[model samples]
Target: MLSGERLSAIRAKVNRAQCSQNKKSATLSSVSINGDRITERKKESFKTANSFIIRGKIEENETLTKRGERSLNCAQQRYVVVVNGKAHTVFTHRCRSRHCQNCQRIKAFVWQEKMKEIIPELSINFKNGKYLFITFTVKNPKITNLRLVLKCMSRAYAKMFQRKAFRFVVGGIRSTEITRGKSGDDEAHPHFHAIICLKTTYFKKENYLSADEWGRHWGECLEAEFKKEGLEYNAADYPKGFPRVDIRVAKSADGKQEITNKNIAEHGDQLINYVLKYSIKGSDLLKDGKADKWFWEFDKQVKGIRMIAPVGVVKKMLADLERDQFDYYKEQEKIEKLIADDVNFKADKAVFKKEDDFDYYMESKKDRFQYIIEAIEAKAYNYQCYYKALLSDHLLAFRSGIDGIIENFKKIKNTKTREGFEILEKAEMGLVKIQCERIERLQFICDALVRVGLYKKMSDFEYVNIHTKDKTTIAKNNIVGVMKAVEEKLLNDFNQDFMRLENAKSQDVFNTVVDRVNEKSALIKLVRNEILAAGAYAYDADNCEYIDLETNERLEVIATIE
Candidate 1:
């Protein structure tokens, strides 16, 4: 099914990617600080005097709350988990503040991963799709007017996208970058860097737009937006014509090689990284190791602006990718849960095999608990990853666990005999016991997070794990009580059915009523027995009634088990 050339290309790409990852890991290890692999770039950005000055500025801002200040100071300490001499950052406690360079790095990495997923699908789905890197710019505006310039640019971008000449454009990823001019911070140079996906036919004469044509269209759009906003557009000020708009094929960072459909899967990262790069260069913000008035104003101007966006088909593709990823993780969690509870299950050592098998520590525990911890620590470092792929959000996890309990409770009514009812009740309890084990796993992970400094205090763990356990416990008891009530009502209806049988005019009719009563009575007994076995109720054989486990109150027996 595969051509040799393509298959070899893929294998080569895989090897290259592996080598890149190994190199990055080595770089991180070399710069490790306090058990964390904080890169020199990130350290310079976050630990420098500039960051402190920025924090001070944030404090002076009267609009920011106490919580907001704390968030702005996020990632003061990095939290990580160590496995086999390697460190992985599980939590950076990022505030995602516009002024934070570390968060910008994290955001870029997230977009890189997204592009890896999006590119291949787009290539396969839209066979004729090709990429073009375009830059649209306007004349320099004063720093004070930068916000207004950005607004006009956004409006113009929307207008251009709807034009007839751009009909072949499926979608694009656009990012706005602002820089300071040579004259200093007084003037701002704002521009857009976009990688647009276009149909192959766009290269034809009918659809193609040359560099001058693109500049003209962009200039017209800007003029229209400026007029709409009641700002004067003076064409005579620019004797050289409208602002320049550069349009070219997407290429490598060095601008030597073009990325075609065939090679996009391997080289698309270059194009993606360029477009999703930092909105403002770090040097521009931290000039001379100080926060200038212009820097602070720029931060406020772009406070809530989305730096990068995927439009049209790109947006839809991203949504579909997210849903698929969600379902995939959910199914993986289900499988791992099943494997964790299988008493006789042994993790295949082959899966954990490495170059030095003798150094492996995962075999230290006999139970599947060790296997689970190994899988968790090896795969995920942060609680966000843990929650997304394994544990889910607290409320959602509790609801899912309670739902499992109720589904098992409902199956009790399918039993047809007293002995079968007792057996099924025991089996269902065994299943619910597995759900309880997950709650224990949640506690284990919470303790690990608190120990690693992700959670500031043990009380945080209690608030999550303890509160969830209490809610689940309450729901379980309530469902058990409801099961008991339903069983009682069903038995009463059966008794009436039996009484009506006594007045049957024929022996056949009486025998039919007796069979129905036996079936209904067995189902009621099954439901009642399950409630008792759940420990929510206990049978007081002497009084021939059920006792509530919590309140110690007596409840009428629904159906006796012979």
Candidate 2:
């Protein structure tokens, strides 16, 4: 009887186990192949761009169904690129991170594709096309004055390109690139790289002002514009400091720089490519963004109206306006209206007087040659270079103490270098050697002189005769004159024309003599018929100062009034 009960219990247990297996099998059979809804729901970030979408190659963002599952067919995709120059290939990839630099290549390619539609319509076939890449850079310690610098640059460039003088079609198509430079500040100081398309067939980018007759045209246009605004566009009086301003024009491809003082920006397709290099797809300085933080703040009142922008940005903007010639705010109001209207307007936009355009606005009034007489005055010594070209190619030689060549004057007759104050005892140039002839003429007076040395006083000076050698060589005598030539050159080279020679004992030494003549501190004292050294003096029509380059002396001699 006991054995029979055990057998019945075991039978009941087997039947329950069989029922559980049947239920589990049913559940497994009901499972759907598209099991993971999360994977299938992933959003695809791509537009159906113009090109053949090789179906197998593109990531369609579809379901994988299971691990390690891929599409039944998969291959690589190809794209054809026809630009102004040549055709190329484009491959697409995932931009894993927004900060990734590699992604820019694909982004640029896509932009090119979009631009193709536009370039075909806007561009006219020019015989030769060139692109000029113009960049507006700010000075170092950018955090302190970055915004003001940028504002000035923006005004200057926008005015330069958009003004009636520049006359490009709607400010030309512009692309913007912003970089922080190597300084590595949190501000990532902003600068702009502009690609200017200059239609060479119609609009020549580079015009030779020094050699060709183009300089007069360039100067006239600039002068009229500056005069209208009461702006001082004197090259001699442009501001001096770091973040030095410069503009370069060269062929769109590898070529020599354009030295001509004209609007030499290249135009057309080649220009487009060069411009695109800087006008790429990223910027640290954006007015608004959906991905990162950007602030529009407001402080203080403008005519009882509130203002807004990032505190630092607005602070800089206001400070920049303050730095201008007090008309900054009124001009800013004009720009505000333009900005509201979304049209390009600049300070150089045929504006009015008592308030010069931006170039003058940027240029502080306290420059060296603000005085009209000073503009034409012969320099004592070279502080930098005499007659620096503010617009065109003014050659400069920057050694410990050398300045570049001023136009037509390969060598200053007797003017000295401000840096070393070493008189040009000799000079050698292409097909022209001036100091040699001067050295020959100086031989006539060498017997009267004691010896030649650097910044040494010639003691016991007696009146002596010197000779000058032009096409006709003739000897001449000189009594009292000043070191005008030497002083001016020194000032031009070093921007310190009057470097006084001091006696350890006498403070009056400063008034008595200076190694350099043209320094702003250098006083020009006029005596009698003979001009004195280190004193404020001037010459009349005939009885004037004669610069003896050989001895580096300035002499005043009697002359018949012409």
Question: By TM-score, who's the top model here?
Answer: 1
- Model 1 worst lDDT window (10 residues): 350-359
TM-scores of all models? Answer: 0.56, 0.25
Q: Candidate 1: how many backbone clashes?
A: 2
Per-residue CA lDDT of candidate 2, range 129-167, in tens?
Answer: 344444444443234333443344444444444444444
**lDDT score of residue 269 within candidate 1:** 81
Compared with the true structure, model 1 gives a TM-score of 0.56
Each prediction's Cα RMSD?
16.2, 34.8
Please report the candidate that would top lDDT against the real structure.
1
Q: Give lDDT: candidate 2, residue 216.
A: 31
Report clashes for each candidate as comma-separated counts.
2, 50
For model 2, the run of ten residues with the poorest summed lDDT: 294-303
